[model samples]
Target chain A: MEVALETNAVFVGIEYLAIFVWGLSGGLSAVRKRYDLFSILTCAWMTALGGGLVRDTLLGDLPPVGITDKGYILTCLASGLVVAVAHPEIMRLKWTMVAIDALGLGLFAVNGTAKALAFGSSGMTAVFLGMATALAGGLFRDLMVGEVPMIIRDKHLYAVPSLIGCILTVIVYKIVRAGTVGMQWEMALDVVIVAVVFVLRMVSVACNLTFPGAVDRGGGASS
Target chain B: MEVALETNAVFVGIEYLAIFVWGLSGGLSAVRKRYDLFSILTCAWMTALGGGLVRDTLLGDLPPVGITDKGYILTCLASGLVVAVAHPEIMRLKWTMVAIDALGLGLFAVNGTAKALAFGSSGMTAVFLGMATALAGGLFRDLMVGEVPMIIRDKHLYAVPSLIGCILTVIVYKIVRAGTVGMQWEMALDVVIVAVVFVLRMVSVACNLTFPGAVDRGGGASS
Candidate 1:
């Protein structure tokens, strides 16, 4: 029997929270870039939803849910509008933004990995897809704003945290399957993965950690 | 009755040519950016195949042919190696590169539009998908290297030609369906769309034509 990852009450709540945070981060990027309203809104929408769209597309899920979900669209728009109107004050709370971004990354990583498994993907594929989902939005936003993707540079442990979370997800999933664990155990493990990812990513961002012998090699390992 | 798009003998030839040229152009961009050999090869692969992957994903086609097909991958890699190793003279022939790029755009636009329709997309959706297919690879390459996408700037007739070709494809498809036209006529129309797109794009590049209102606000309009 195959296990299906249901978007339960907690999952749904976390998704909305993650989306809003993603939108806020996207708005911050737009403000920093000094983009006009149209571009700002677009950036918000894409950054909040583009990852899911790309993930679903790669999975051959037609008519991406991100495009069809009205709540997600409204959340992105609301965040974009708010940031456009009050960007100076919002930009000042840089740490707050980073904290929210870390949460978004963890949530997306765990959710994407679970979805991939539910879709019957192999463990490795699920891990790869999960990291891709976690990073897609930021990559899209960076590209649109004409900047090199930070993930590509291996800086600040961005993809690293997501990758670790995804790997852990795969491990937990296999254990649950092997032992016939209950849904409650699966949920607990999922939460643990998200927490681990959040802590790892947030610490790296706060400490300005960088990946060495990989990229940005000549620079100091810490800012 | 469903309409099927066949990648026939001529279409296959043009597609390979386009992929090779796209790879070469990507290699050129990598060299200009002073990227390492690995980066240059990755750039080439993305530029040559990214558009098709995006298009196929939109159409819910799994495992994009670009990735699954070894021949296509080899073509891109070979083209990248050649251009990366000997870019000085290749870079000098700017006009030649532009001409080939035009042809590639035309072929991709026509092919993508037909594929969308084959997958049961609406005519307008097909047109949109087609232009996106023509533009996606270039956009990916630009963003990867941290530059504004030229298509967004709208300085050239890049997207315009593709859009026209896509619309033409729709019209042809409708005619073929309504009149019960044979496969030969359908194939002929496909060729016509490609030719028209190629000619329009090439002429614009040669004449430095800029789309009015869309991008270049102040211009002679005729030029």
Candidate 2:
């Protein structure tokens, strides 16, 4: 939680960018589902902020950062409004949306874990919180749209890369003894984890990589 | 949070009953949707425990009581397993499930408000959290099962009665000066609110009561 104060100024740009991209996807998803405007706003906010809300709450931080920050709320709403007005055009740029989403996912996963560690969470709890921060919004959106959550059902490797990012974050914290480390190191580690998550997610998508265990073997399985 | 300890012994009976009933409905919902058994357990936990988890997290309580208490988890899973294996027989007792669900809804709404007040939250916030604790799980379950959430889209008044109960609970706290009040008054208030919710929910179902505002006017101007 304290780390947020230091990162707030430097990373404000990326944060808003991530929020906008995530919120846009959320709005587009709701529009595609034929949900009304109010529902579109809900989807947009969920996609942009739900993960952070869950992470903060799990960390025993009430009045989640996402809710308390006016800028965060406005940025998410702006993205939703943009999508609502320009959905047809946005839909045409599908790959662009995917790339932006991947970027948001990585940044969120890294920051979420680091924040949890700053709040004194154990390594495993921090990892879980990080992944939740990255993936919960999409799961929420998928459910809201009456679809099975892609994270659990689709072999997209969405959670896998997020997990790796979160783990790397914890490892960096462990090596540097987070509290004693310099802010620059913490920020640098954040960049590294985000890059790792972004690259892994993009590569997995491009190469169509997935966990073998998730595939259905059909009725011929020996079991 | 402290109130839970004092009320735990006296209310433990009703708590388990609510958990069992909610869990059963969750499992039944998943079974009806032809979801896998693991998904059935997920539905059951979400229906029986998700509300509490959200409430606790929002209140800045770490390790939600629902998760910390082994009995709670087991009860939810047990109910899910029971329904998964015996759904046809369980579905036959449709009225029974309704009665039990109404009971669970009442208990959760009342206790959720009381718990929030005990945690030193404001009156309105307590009311909001109470309604959330009662209704969120069902909303989560409905979403998971690929249905328009009954609370938001359906005319069943699922949340209306729960809201009334939660508001009544906060009012009771205001009149009683919660922290200064004895366990007896607290317990008495819980029973009264639960009774009100149960009666209202059942009567609404029986007499088909619903908010006139929620009714869609369709294309016609008037009737």
Q: In terms of DockQ, which candidate is strongest?
A: 1
Error of 2 at A221 (Å): 22
lDDT of 2 by residue, A8-72 (tens): 56566777888999999889989998889899999999988999988877777877987998999
- Against the reference, the lDDT scores of all candidates come to 0.79, 0.79
Give interface RMSD (Å), model 2. 7.9
Q: What share of the true interface contacts does each candidate keep?
A: 0.19, 0.17
Native interface contacts retained, candidate 1? 0.19
Which docking category, incorrect, acceptable, medium or high, applies to candidate 1?
A: incorrect
Those runs of model 2 whose alpha carbons end farther than 4 Å from true positions after fitting are: A1-50, A57-118, A122-128, A140-149, A152-223, B1-6, B34-42, B53-89, B121-125, B144-146, B153-157, B171-183, B206-223
Cα lDDT, model 1, residue B218: 75
TM-score of 1: 0.60
Please list the residue runs of candidate 1 whose C-alpha ends up more than 4 Å from where it truly belongs after superposition.
A1-50, A57-114, A120-128, A140-149, A152-223, B1-5, B23-96, B140-148, B152-156, B179-181, B207-223
lDDT of 1 by residue, A1-223 (tens): 2333344677677777778778877877888878899888899888999998887878776677789989889989998898888888877888887887888888888878877788877776677568768988988887777777656443477877888988998898988888878656987788888889989988887788754321222222112
